[model samples]
Target: MAFEEAKIRFKGSISPVITPFEEDESIDFKLFKRLIDWHIESGSHGISVTGTSGEPSSLTIEERELVMETAMKTVDGRVPFLPGTGSVNHRETLRLTKAAQEMGADGAMVIVPYYNKPNQQALYNHFKTVAKSVDIPIILYNIPGRTAVNLEVDTIARLAEDCPNIIGIKESNKDFEHVNRVLLKCGRDFNLYSGIELLCYPMLAIGGAGHISATANVAPRQVAEIYNAWAEGDVTRAQHMHFAMMPLNDVLFRDTNPAPVKAALGMMGKIKPVLRKPMELPSKEIQQEIRETLMQYALVL
Candidate 1:
């Protein structure tokens, strides 16, 4: 299928879903399926997984594929499912992206090559190759904080011009000017999304498609409402939701991601507070802080 012919339009609060794990450090498909349903039920606009929040590094390739298959089955086209299919290795990124395309994903979110810190020209070549390999829309994931390299606006604009399937980006970058420049260079129709929680509304204000915020993992409806409200022409409500989410956005990142997020979910009885080795839960002080933050929204659990 050509990118134009594909029916799904990636937008709104596409949750970078956390992979639920059993207490024994196994993938918890049952809980995973339920979590997908919960995000849908909670009015998240789309579902995405195997991204940073999903702990993609911890899972084997086979485990990632199984999770993707289960997500496809469970989502059942109710909302778009975009899977993170990128890796540091070029071949691995290609293989996983092809796998996602085969699994009926609405699109693939490919991160910039990390660790190796490829040059802009190399980044362009790598993404163009990946885009050519799959017909699905390829949204570039530019998270310099974790990746240790920035996907410069010029490079991204070049890819947008060169690869039709290479669409917009999910920027976790803190530089507001850089993001603004992306929209200016890539044109407003480019499907830019904010991966940073605090910038979700600000991004929308400047023509962002939507967000894939980690905050959505704990507060889906409120998070989605920021976009929905803005789309509905209620700037006041959208601004309100944005500020409402600020404390949550702050608390969830008191520690590393998914730890506080998964811990928050666990406290709400959504999933086990289990993480694979080397990724521990939030400290007791942080957990208590997370608990108090959730209470502000009346999430007493």
Candidate 2:
């Protein structure tokens, strides 16, 4: 599909799948492929790997590239394959993004430079350089809580104006006003995805594209249903799914990211609850909470 046509199709629940690991802390390619196929079968509009949920920062460049290759190969153009290719290092970001383009990925999600706290101009330069380098669509990831820096709305609009391929953004911040401002400034056609799970329905309600959420890892059908409901003009059903998903969303983030999500996946017997170093399984208390929440949704018995 042409990039233009693909942008329209990208406006739905895109699952940022967790990178499953073995007990030895190696990437579980077997489990990873299974998760991708499951997401597609479960109704995820698209599949993303190596995002925050996938623990991109923990994996090496080679490992990240391998994950992207695996996702693209598994997806096989069944649904859009968007891989998170950003890093704190610009060179590494460019390398992975270039690889994504060459590997036939539909688009790439590049995160804001974390820890360094680059100013708005520096952020612009970073994205502009990458967008210029790659031919595929670019989705800027703005998670101030994790990155310690916000991609200001003006800077976002500027990037959209300056780089045509810098087409969309994943607004992970809690501030809904940022979502409004991006749409107002960048135009309604600019694909704005809500990375915050709770904001998914609201984002779609406001002329935004869709969500690239971690919660979708456990509830892909529900999450995709929310978007499908809204698209079909069933506001009532959409709202129901939105609120129904709240508890699961909360539990998934009870700890730091994919830990809770990975745990839930294990409980469902989809994959083993394993994470790389510095990211162990969720605590016993949180694991129980996750189980209770999933039971409420009947995801686990």
Measured by lDDT, the strongest candidate is 2
Each model's lDDT comes to 0.91, 0.93
What TM-score does model 2 achieve against the real structure? 0.98
Q: Candidate 2 residues 1-301, lDDT tens each?
A: 5656767988899999989988888999999999999999999999999989999999999999999999999999999888999999999999999999999999999999899999999999999999999889999999999999999999999999999888799999899988899999999899999999999999999997899999999989999999999999999999999998898888899999989999999999998899888888888999999999999999999
lDDT of 2: 0.93
Q: Candidate 1 residues 120-211, lDDT tens each?
A: 99998999999999888989999999999999999999999998987779999999999999999998888889999999999999999899
Q: How far is 195's C-alpha from truth in model 1 (Å)? A: 0.5
Candidate 2, after superposition: displacement of residue 214 in Å? Answer: 0.4
> Cα-based RMSD of the predictions, in order?
1.3, 0.8
Q: Provide TM-scores for the models.
A: 0.97, 0.98
Residue 252 of model 2, lDDT score: 91
Off by over 4 Å in 1: 1-8
